[model samples]
Target: MLQRPTMPGYAAPQDLIRRVRRTWFLFFVVAIVIIAAALAGAEFYGRRSAIEALESQGRTDANLKVALLTAVLERPRALPLLLSEDQQVLDALSSANSQAIEILNRKLERLVTGTQAAVLYVVRPDGIAVSASNWREPLSFVGNDYNFRDYFRRAMEQGTAEQFALGSVSKRPGLFISRRVGSAVAPLGVVVVKMEFDRLETDWQSASRPVYVTDNHGVVLITSIPSWRFMTSGAIPQQDLASIRSSLQFGDAPLAPLPIKNPAILNPGASIVSAVLPGSGEAKYLRLLAAVPTTPWQLEYLVPIETPVASAVQTARLTALAFLLPVLAIAAFLLRRRQVSVMRIATEQAMREELERRVVERTEDLSRARDRLQAEISDHRDTEAKLQVVQQELVQANRLAILGQVAAGVAHEINQPVATIRAYADNARVFLERKQTDPVEENLGAIAALTERIGTITEELKAFARKGRVAPEPVDLRGVIEGAIVLLRSRFSGQLNALDAQLPPPGLFVMGNRIRLEQILINLLQNALEALGDRSDARVEITVTETSDEAAIAISDNGPGIPPAILDSLFTPFHTSKEQGLGLGLVISKDIVADYGGRIEVSSSDRGTCFTVYLLKAKT
Candidate 1:
């Protein structure tokens, strides 16, 4: 054996083939794993992006529904509150005379037509409808008893009430907005404005996605699907159901769970669920809910998820396959080339060492330069942080300065209302002492009105001081002008009587918040009034004009005009000619106008001073 070792037996062809097959199988398995991992990563990223897009669309749709619902519901709110205090409504309720009732009914009829209200009615304390906008119709609310209705009881007790329910007579689902008439002590009646969402529902039905609104108890009050109406999103407890039934909130309709399945919450206000459509089979949907402010309701939007999910998965798989083939081929080629290049690599080993030494020297130099650059970057970042802090402080200081300037004017405006209320109260006491019931009631009403005015002024000031605001919408310029004049009436009553107003026609509108626009007008008018102070023949004029894309309002006063020295800096903050002026009025006004993409300009001379505001015209 030591002399000659027996030659090893040659491997059988079958064994050699078996080993090669096993190696190839293992290689394919690893390749499949790599391909699968890549596919999974692609799918994950694709699905996440799709979900984000769906959520964005869901939010937009939810917000749109809220706006539409708010606009429709708000149309009739002022109707009930304002009409409840109307002289005719009060007289009709107090006297119950047929003639007064007739006049009140006609007035209500006109109002209903003008406002597109479903119905406007006045219910007596006994819950009998005394006057209605549809009194002449066969289905008139007049003489109908609503004593069992929650809105009537709540309005009488709470001064105002809002309830969504099926109308007892009309048998239609609507919101009943009610306000109590007269003083709480001797309430005359309740004013009601019934608002139906038939048109809104119709519009929603035409949309691509499903939309609905649910009450506090999760009952579907308004929905795109008629069949879904009056349905509950979840089970109601026995006690709550009994209360709802007693109130007849949804008539005799059964409150059952909606036909939604397997709901998985995605976030606080968004979820994914399966729902069955009338014509279609089971489908997955992304549902989103947004709370409607000022109401105990939520707007819900449902968008189909099947298309997006399928698209995402299919796209990811195709993309992964496209990348996997090239990657696998390149890897195989590299492996073969590495084997073939072994001898060539050994031949170049010495050359590579020399190159590597030079590369190391360069690398050290680059490392040093990188450290110096990183240090510079760090210094720059520190400087930027300090600058940002200073910038924030300056912004805060500017806001405080503006607030201080307007504080005095706001106080003066509020003070006038307080004085008027005090005077009215004194007059009411005198009339009561003399046993003059009518005059005493009139004075008391005036006092109440003034108190409300004071509240409104203070609320406006508070809102102005706040940093946030509602989005601007189309605001009627004429209405804002009239509102400012009314607010300033007591301040410059004698001056306002002589002031000339040349306004555009009723519907001229600009893009801005109504309250802010009114504030601008008030500031302008107050300045004009002060300029014309103590002049017997003083004159102030407000004129509204329009171009193709802009609305211009000019406020002019005939007095010793703004001095030339201060004319250029008239709108500059803290710059004023008046002895007691903090000078933020014009600055604030300019800012407001600019926020609406408008401009303010002033021209002054010895003859007179004029301030003009230009605002973008709102699309009709």
Candidate 2:
């Protein structure tokens, strides 16, 4: 028989498909069994074990709460008993004197702070409160009568008594522990200690579990939930409710049944009960109880079991998956190995194609990298170009702004020249009429000279106002100083006459654009003139000092130096002492100087302010 042609190391298509199908069929069957077994085990045993665990924890917690309550109760229980036997309390009860009562009041006040008792007081045989710990407070118990209180009556009859009731005077509910002083035959009075459960209730709330303490009558005296207090654990008989109400012990409490429901006994001592607790909504708890020592109070602890039980079930399911997944993985590995053995030849060919694809991918990666580098380089060049444009714009703007400021002065200077030119022209016309050619020629020439002067002033202004950023070059210092003064002369006509400049030697030069250098000089000179402001004794000074590598020119003013407050911000843009000043003059000057690798320094005192401009010295 002839067989079909096959790849050297690959299985036949028909055999491969059949094996894959069988493998999937077996996997599905095994997975179904594993899941069913896991769920069944969790349902059958996990819930039972969870309940048992929670019940154990609930019992331990309940017993702990009972011990805590006992400790709180026992601490105050001795307070009244000890005070009853004390001489101070007995003396006050027997003395009936103001001095003894005052002494006992102070002692009780001090004792109450040291102990947990909210208030400690002594009552006479007739049940009138005389001396109390709260005597100093506004609602002092020093004069209150407690003859009708159940604790007072019970203690008078039995020598000692404990009762939890709402106080008639204070309106706050607390436990009253009272003890009879002296022997029953000659009883002095009752020493009563009122204890509040606020702190104990707060502790229970922190445990994150619902807890309540119910008295012999099933009325909740202390509970983690404040609203549950005075509520009964179950329904009370009409007659009993009436009797309790008549005693005036629980105040205006409704005495209704608690909101507990759906009780199911899980064990002899532990049961599951549902209740809607404050802030917790309705939930099931593992209910356990322990009697509060010496108080006929039963402490009920409720541990929420739903979360722990669900968690245990989930844990069981995970445990099952943990075992089942490994076996399935092993089976998958064996199948994978068998399949890979048959596919080795095909894998080699596929690998060759994959390698070619990777080579092509690497080439594309290189192309993308080159493209990114080119883009980054283009971005840098664009940013540099934009920076240069912005810098040129800034210099042009500052120049135009100064030119606008001095336009009026420039117009005034041109007007003077025009008036002289007109005068010379009139004279020339007269000379020509008189037939004096030489005089007419001279007059015409003078008029021409005046016009030329006007033209020169305007041309200087135009040059200052033009926009451009020029590369730094060696510039004569004298030319920059003279140029700035020429612009300011018209603006400050008389002020310029006071300028005392000590110019540097001829041929001395600094590296910077000449226009920008003149702008820096104009800013300094204009500021100094404005500061002098027509003072009779006003003086301005410009002194230039040069070194081989650097040159510094200092401009000083005798006018009241820049105000101490504004001196520091002199170079800060928009910070100005002048009410109408935009405050950009010195700032632009500082930037220009910095661009030429230079800086400006300013100093001011009571007598004067000085600004020094430093520039890099350049070869002439």
Candidate 3:
């Protein structure tokens, strides 16, 4: 079949044209879908970005307002304290007595009642009210005393006035300011200023919209919009007032305190963000809210929801048209001429080149992203490590606390024995001179016992040091108990006292660092002795009881039991009932027991106080 070269299944011109047309139809459909998707995405992202940017700007503005207000109110924070004793303002008020305060109050009422914020009161350093904006302020104030207030005293002592600042208006939403009267050298009283809702109304006139400044409390300081529902300040519901008040009085001191960072917003679900009044309910309104951390106030600017949307409508339409025109043109070009062989070839080559360029750009972007992720991980790990170190330091501090508590008794016990030893040796030297060998030997034996006691005391101290080393082993509970007794015996084994011990068998054991364990016993015993020291029938009893699973050593004294107030805080670091106490003993002892999976408890009543320590039984 040597026929002419067979062009197998090759498309004729008509068939080729039909296939090209079909491909073009499919591309046109795909292009339309892609363009629609891009426009929709752009609209969604743009709206969200716009909202976020607006909110951020609002917050910035609120912060600035709060800072300025705080700078004005700090003066008042001090005036309340200093006014009672200020010589000048007090002299002025005292000159008029009750009438003096009344007249001054009226003057202030005129100055502040119609202003943006209400003035609460102005008082002299001697604590007499000079003026007040609100009549109610006069009842509890005006000639009343302020001597007990620390704020007043500090202002006088410093002989300087506090600067203005922002705070809660009567703990509500308002602006407060105060200024000292007279000269700095011989100050008079202070001029207290407050601006509440009425004041806000004055300022609201300056703003275009129906605006109001409210605190976390729903208390409205100022508002331009007048609704019958919000006609009266007290008419506002309590919950709403509270919310607004809180928002207004937020801390303004930039250096006050940083919020906890782990979870940036301390309260979840609650809007840490500020928002516009939002039409009293869930009705959405365009609002700009700011969280002003300095004086920590929330500044809100509320507008009709329709306003922001309307303002943006014109721009939105222009952008949509701008984006849509190009997309339609590209789609149309793809549809037309697509059936031509030459056009198809060119389009295919263009698409391939575009894909290659995208691939190269994507590779570089991915590389940078990976590097950033690794660096973030490293930083996170370092932060975690630092937190762990801080936690350990806190733990070590607890250990030192207990040692510090018992140090006093330990010093007394050790020193008494040393003093007795010195006296006995000195007596022996005199006896030797008188040729009395027998008395000299007796004194020598007494000295040896005291020296041994001193050695035992030093051993207990070695365990109290805080360090990185842990040396725990099986130790006989009986021996530890007796060693503690021997160290305290010389000091407490006096004429009017009795000390007793009921130690368990030698086989009873606990696993602990020997020095630390002994130190704990000494601490408990010393506390018992001190408790019984002042009693004529002073008696201290020690009893050790054991079971298969655990062992307990109890110390009881026939003295007044632990005070109810101090019982709970006994083991807390740096807490003590004793006047001269360092307050570390129980805390250190508690930690030591916990380290070995043990516990210590104290019980007290009229019968007296008892401390019981339970240690896990070492395996036989």
RMSD to native for every prediction?
A: 23.5, 30.6, 30.6
Clashes of 1: 0
Worst lDDT run of 10 residues, candidate 1, spans 1-10
> Counting only residues 3 or more apart in sequence or on different chains, how many pairs clash (N, Cα, C under 3 Å) in candidate 2?
0
Worst 10 residues of 3 by lDDT: 1-10
In order, candidate lDDTs are 0.82, 0.79, 0.57
Kindly indicate the candidate among 2 and 3 with the higher lDDT.
2
Off by over 4 Å in 2: 1-41, 318-620
Tens digits of lDDT, candidate 1, 512-563: 9877787788888888898888899899999988987899999998889987
Predicted candidate 2, C-alpha RMSD:
30.6
lDDT of 2 by residue, 8-39 (tens): 32233556456657766786798788779878
Cα deviation of 376, candidate 3, in Å: 75
lDDT value, residue 102 of candidate 2: 95
Give residue 205's error in model 1 in angstroms. 1.3
Q: Order of all candidates by lDDT, from best down to worst?
A: 1, 2, 3
Between which residue pairs do clashes occur in model 2? none
Model 1 Cα shift for residue 216 (angstroms):
0.4
Kindly report the root-mean-square deviation of model 1 from the true structure over all alpha carbons.
23.5
